[model samples]
Target chain A: MAETPIRFGILGCAHIAQTVSRAICLSPNSTLYAVGSRSFEKAKKFSEANGFPPSAKIYGSYEALLDDPDVDVVYVPLPTSLHLRWVVLAAEKKKHVLLEKPVALNVAELDEMIKACEVNGVQFMDGTMWMHHPRTTKMEEIIYDPERFGNIKTVHSIFSYGGGDDFLRNNIRVKPDLDGLGALGDAGWYCIRAILWAAEYELPKTVTALREPVLNEAGVILACGSSLQWEDGKTATFHCSFLANLAMDITVLGTTGTLHVHDFVIPHEENTASFLAAAKTGYWELVTGMSAIPSQHVITTDLPQEVYMVTEFSRLVKSIKDGGSKPEGKWPSISRKTQLVVDAVKASIENGFEPVQVRV
Target chain B: MAETPIRFGILGCAHIAQTVSRAICLSPNSTLYAVGSRSFEKAKKFSEANGFPPSAKIYGSYEALLDDPDVDVVYVPLPTSLHLRWVVLAAEKKKHVLLEKPVALNVAELDEMIKACEVNGVQFMDGTMWMHHPRTTKMEEIIYDPERFGNIKTVHSIFSYGGGDDFLRNNIRVKPDLDGLGALGDAGWYCIRAILWAAEYELPKTVTALREPVLNEAGVILACGSSLQWEDGKTATFHCSFLANLAMDITVLGTTGTLHVHDFVIPHEENTASFLAAAKTGYWELVTGMSAIPSQHVITTDLPQEVYMVTEFSRLVKSIKDGGSKPEGKWPSISRKTQLVVDAVKASIENGFEPVQVRV
Candidate 1:
């Protein structure tokens, strides 16, 4: 008996496409059958350099690639502004989609994509690969289990970096129309996604934001804060900046203790410690041993990006083949909630940081 | 040879006055010579109970006590509404003053008090006692020393608690006219003071704030954030909350490591840990074998409150006796900068969280 592999097509030869291409090639249950770019020459060059089968089709237009009946699932790694168009088109072709982060420019586009997938009887999953990591799973279990981490009271997270001039010159991340929220749409979504995933995809009730717009640039928010409230009466906050030096840290405070994770988005090989303080006397005793590590975890992989993307794509393929939902699939809920947070942040920036309640 | 004792008088028997009274009685070079309350019976009772000498006077009116030539200093712990009037009157009477926190209702009042003290050639100090503690000196030294703490990047601090019903029911902290900014004027001042003091009183260029009015029952701000810029081209942020459960934590981040100071405001026997990461490995290591000392230094004596108050009052007396500026004195600078931060927070709140540029 031989195992059958799901056929995958790559749309848009963007840098992110390399991630999906490698994942599809490496997964035993998936195959990269075809690829499409705005230029046929570029598509052919990428396929040949990446060791694609000679039978793998190359198309100059995305629609031409979508016309292939053999392409089972389409991986859309286009710019943020083009996600809705390609996702809906892929669904119309009776194909499932693995859309990149900032799934769409706003909730309306996401809603349309969701409806398209439902009407076509196809699956739609946002490409939030961090959610698939083993460490993320461990963190979620610890944070949600009352006996392990206790009831969460507050969450503080930051993701920031200084995008050098060469990187910002011609990148879609700096474009107002394509990227919409700029750094927020580019990298902040991961931080927002991390919070939502940890909170079990609970939509927050209110979001307050403050943005320092990049000078001489319109629709580019350099820094922002999104304060979120869940229906279960839990609150969370996400802070992000693009004009500052790099930083990625997430801290979750519960009634009994706090869990601090560093570099949450990119699982770096680092050690983290949790500090617990229950009573006044206990607090003093704990402070004395604060520098001692009770536990430490290490990741030795230099390919976290490929590892996360492959795990999520493999799960998506298995779900389609079995005619069942993906394992712990919270993509739709997470996507919708992330869109709410993004919209609230924009509204807050426009209103001078007066908190905007998220209706969703 | 005997040390000359400074004569002191208190105008009210407020809650804070109790702390000052105890300090006066314990200082070796200070004497509580008189006390004045609106009710004669209350003044007489307090004087007798506190063991004032037979020569000590009890007055039914504050005006009579101020007229006493024997009194060299006065402590004013009245309601926020009466701070300006009494501080000015005390200064006019040629008495040095130790005015309680929230120096005045607004910056204008603070300015008036500063001017009155200057014109009368009398010393006036805002009783921001946290700066007097040894821990403050240690924190400043650690944060500013690049070799020890590296480049300061971020700061987050919180102060909150639950108060007595009566304290919230009829106190000026609940009234807009007297308490002004409410919780912000009362408990929130400590948080603002800590951040400004840690930043060495470098005013921020722009501040953005968000106030949740529903959370403040007694004219208090439930939560607020102020984005600040230092003269050294660094950005800092301060957050405060009164409605949440008790929490006082301050975390300072630098390039090489992070200093996490638990229980920042009233750090009673709490401890802090430093986590460092080298540039090459980018691996964070918890520096071990560190002793857990009290988060704050205890200036203990037979009477702790008295010892704390006298520590500052005596400094002022010695400065006057020397007829020159005290090199060790930080009261003037700390008080002025604290008032500046308080004023900025108030202006940000009033203008609907508009960025208020701090002047000097």
Candidate 2:
């Protein structure tokens, strides 16, 4: 028997919601049934332009969307400062949530979200699309094989992008109160998540951080470094910068050898296109070889092959409908850990880049 | 007129003295004029075996050697624990001093040494041989060119060697109170010094360090990581380990590209007899190309390359004799900075690897 598609209602007409909506439309067992935005005109336009079915609905406000019985799940794509409020509301409405990256701004907010989900008996998962990528699985396989990679000694990860002057204005990225965290929260979160996930989500024994502040007439950290360690003696160092130009790379050093994965966050458009073409043609070798080349030339051409976030969301909906326990041991925990790390970064910045012990 | 060679004195008959003594013999404008050891028999044996000129004197003790007016400069290669005391004594005696690597156990001791040198009106330089190597100068030139290498973003350095269990027994390296600083201060000094020198000896604005203690009969650090920042917003990081097998390499990442120099601390040995014959017969290109390939198939050999420390010491002697200030920008200040960094590592270890501000 064919499985019924899970219906999704996006809580905000955020720019990220477009990515999620596209993913839902393309997913084998998911549908973008509705959308809600503070502005009624924006919601209606989003629904119309995205080709929502006649049965699909548009709501002027988030609460009205949550009240809709047809919506089985909610995709929360709100500002970092606003995540906790909508996430709890969505969970209270008994809708499974795929909250956007950085589950919440801090551990306290995350704890509240988790509690609300538990009390309402709803599944809560973070939208960490990279975890679902086949390449990440392959990385785990290679790193765990003692004969292949050996014990990891050090991990150096970097994620940066040139956010020119225009990038700082009219975006949540540069808003000190709304975003709270800057480059470290936006891009650096991915690198930190990848490391902790690869290290089996082990809580660091100690953490020391440094920050570079690019304030908006008001002082706040706009960039930073968060260095961490495991009790068994492994070091994780991450560099997060906003003033610097675009660069996203991760390098892990082990006792036997090293492994590097370039463009770990947002892969090149060409790589994705080629990957999809090869996937359609059953040419796995060509896809793998294309991925192996580290040059930007190949990556820039290949990355647009698939919509990573939508694909992961589709899987989450299927898992929930099948009554499986929330894609056990995956994105939820990873995203929570990522939020904790960001919280630590903020604490360190507040204390003048001092070492802050992460509380799991 | 040709400059007069600086007459040098040996303060101890240690293995390091043998290397220095050989370098002095090979230098064009330097000579070993006096030998000193706690044992008269050992001093006489060393003088006779090394063919010290008949007019050269031997001293039964360090004080007697300092009393000899002919001994214009003293090379002190005592154990790590004794470096401070003897350096101070040599400065008080008004003898130009070249102290061995790891100028002192910590910043406090280094400050004392610096103060002593200033008050006594004598020249003092740390014996960090790599800083004087022409290859190192070439590396600095390449890394600092903004058009060529651009701004450096990351520095990864490693130096490790394996030693037998018996080697740890009775060695100062294994004694925390004697060596005071373990692998980090003993061998990792070069790795830190290399980064600072390559970065034009910029003082880091912030530092985060992690250390691992190796347990034998007593606990000693075996590995460490340091993240540093320059005032101009450039950041650098380094790791050092001694528990691993023999390996020494340094890699720098810049905005434009990456550069790596392998086997940086030591060059591969060359067979002098075969090389001399090949050169005389005009087989230079073929022989040199074959030798350039790094592999186990090549035979171990030695080259007639210039001795790094001896050449630098000769230049320092000339600078002093010419009545000019010591080389304005040299390795001593860099060495002091590195010592301060290592001391922070020690403090971090004591405080459970918490972030400590470097005071240098």
Please state the Cα-based DockQ of model 2 relative to the true two-chain complex. 0.04
lDDT of 1 by residue, A327-358 (tens): 33356767888887888778877887677888
Enumerate residue pairs that collide in model 1.
A204-A229, B23-B306, B182-B219, B183-B220
User: Taking the tens digit of each residue's C-alpha lDDT, what string does model 2 give over B118-150?
Assistant: 687667787776565555655666667777556
Q: State candidate 1's DockQ.
A: 0.08
Residue A360, candidate 1: how far off, in angstroms? Answer: 4.1
Per-candidate TM-score, first chain only? 0.89, 0.86
List DockQ for all candidates: 0.08, 0.04
Per-residue C-alpha lDDT of model 1 across residues B1-360, encoded as one tens digit per residue: 986788889897775666567667777878889999998889888787775788888999899999998788888877777888988898898888888877777777777877777777677776665555455665676667777555655555655443335656666666776766666666667777777665666666666554433345444554555655555545555555443434555656554434555455544432322222222113222211112211322333243333455656766766775566533335555666766777787677778766788866
The TM-score between candidate 2 and the true structure equals 0.66
